[model samples]
Target: MAKLDLRGVRKSYGTVEVIKGIDLTVDHGEFCVFVGPSGCGKSTLLRMIAGLESITGGEVAIGEEVVNAIPAADRGLAMVFQSYALYPHMTVRQNLSFGLENIQTPKPQIREKVEAVAKMLQIDMLLDRRPKDLSGGQRQRVAIGRAVVREPNIFLFDEPLSNLDAELRVDMRGEIAALHKRLGNTMVYVTHDQVEAMTMADKIAVLRLGELEQFGRPLDLFNNPANLFVAGFIGSPKMNFLQGRTDADDRNRLILDTGDTIDLPEGRFTQAPGQTVTLGLRPTELQPDPDGALHAHVGAVEQLGSESYLYGTFQNETPVTVHNPGQTTIRPGDKVALTAKSTAMHLFDTETGLTLRG
Candidate 1:
């Protein structure tokens, strides 16, 4: 296995700078995922590690070796792409063995390696099938098998599951996780799917607009996002933002626009009184209460078998969502009173879009 490191990595195409300077580290035998929206320089960053793209400035190291000068073939890493990129005419077995053959591997060793990988991937029966004869999932497995045959120090996957149907994608996700557990090789996977990154990665690196937004464990980013962008980006059904101004009601309370006041400990907002700020509330954080802090008219409801999400407008003209049990009786246009659990509440500055921490 290898440890991959990037130090102030920057990429520019002529006058246009696509990837701003980025610094990241992937420990040996670790599975790190890079995720962000399109044009966020995610794929460009991956290609730089693969030596498919040249670095404008900075260093990429694999296992203590600086690979900025190394050729792609000598990088000691294997890549699986979005497309299967397999040989159309060659059978699965031949495709897996092709790489070893090019490196002049002995015939007996090549046969053993191909058989072992095919068996491990549970594709032993499909070894004789050509690319056209294989299912999408099978073709993906073959692409991965080709990488396995090389036995490289690191594995790189670029949206390898994007082509599959939802069911197939879930199935292959488990398969990839199992593969990683079995091989224990260093892996760097890039995908726009936050679900994939959250589920598959030991650590996730979130990117936005050519910059690294946040890098941490999935739950860490979910619980305490660094900035407002991450606070809104990392969660499902998104957090609700309520426009409100803070004011001193008594010795220790910050009043909201709707006359709802949050009791605070001493010195909570010493410098920002009467400041316009946003109250960040997650759908899961809102609870049903008879004497709740906010009142709203439910506009719509979504039932997801185990839970329900309520879309509504607050009295202060702020849109909000509340998540509750699947058996909730709340319906569209129903009036409801809800309370915000302060422990689950987030506060952000209106001007900078940054979270306010006590």
Candidate 2:
């Protein structure tokens, strides 16, 4: 396996730039995920690394060698695409061995590789079946097995599990994570689903509108988001935002437009009084309090057997979503009071959307 590096990488077409300067590195044997919303240029950036898309500027290096001009075939990387892209007429075994055959691998070596990959992916029994005869998950495993047979320097997965059903996607997510643990190869995966990125990656690069918003460990991005965009994107239930401004009478407090006050840690917030700041609270961080600062009229309550979530509006306008552990008696149209732990609060500059807490 090798390290993957991107130094000020860029892509453009006719005066329009899709990928703004991106400088990132995926260390050897690490699972790195690129996650963002659609139209975020994540797939475009992955294609550039695969040498399928041209770089408008900067460098792409595999290990120590610059591979900007290297063809995809010579880059020693294996890519499993979103589409199965399997040959309809070929059996699973044939699909698994084709890449090695093209590269003139010995017949015995090819057979060994195909057999091992098939067993490793748990598709050994389906080797004789054609693509049309296999299930979606099986077809995907065949595609992944094809990549595994080659033992490339890096593995690139472009939403490889996107086509599977919800249940199977979860199963395959664990399978791929186990595959990485066993092989220990450098892998770069791209997905629009933050859940997938959080569950499967050792490191995550969150992107937006062709630019990298932040890159770090999953929990780091979750706990210490650099800005509003990231704070809202990385969590499952999504963080809540309350419109507020610095206290005119005191720099260490925020006065929400909802007519509530939040005490801030001294030396943590330096914004001038009256400057607009946003308070972010994750749904999970909220708790029931009889005289809590948050006052909301519950609009909807979802009980999923294990837990419940309350949807409501704070002070008649600002929407709030609260996650509660276990089952709850909270019902729609009921008045509820909530409070947030001091550490749960995330403050951001409303103008620039940058985080205000140091």
lDDT of 2 by residue, 95-146 (tens): 9989999999999999998998898999999999999999999999999999
The TM-score leader among the candidates is: 2
Candidate 2 — worst ten consecutive residues by lDDT sum?
262-271
- Evaluate all candidate structures by whole-model CA lDDT and list the values in order: 0.87, 0.93
lDDT of 1 by residue, 1-358 (tens): 4999999999999989888889989999889999998889999999999999999999999988999989999999899999999999899999999999999999999999999999999999999999999999999999999999999999999999999999999999999999999999999999998889889998899999888988888899888877788888778878887766766445345566755666544554332767777777789888778898678889998888898889888876678889897758888989988887877777778788776766
RMSD of each: 2.2, 1.0
TM-score of each model, paired residue for residue? 0.93, 0.98
Candidate 1, run of 10 with poorest lDDT: 262-271
Clashing residue pairs for model 2: none
Tell me model 1's lDDT, rounded to 2 decimals. Answer: 0.87
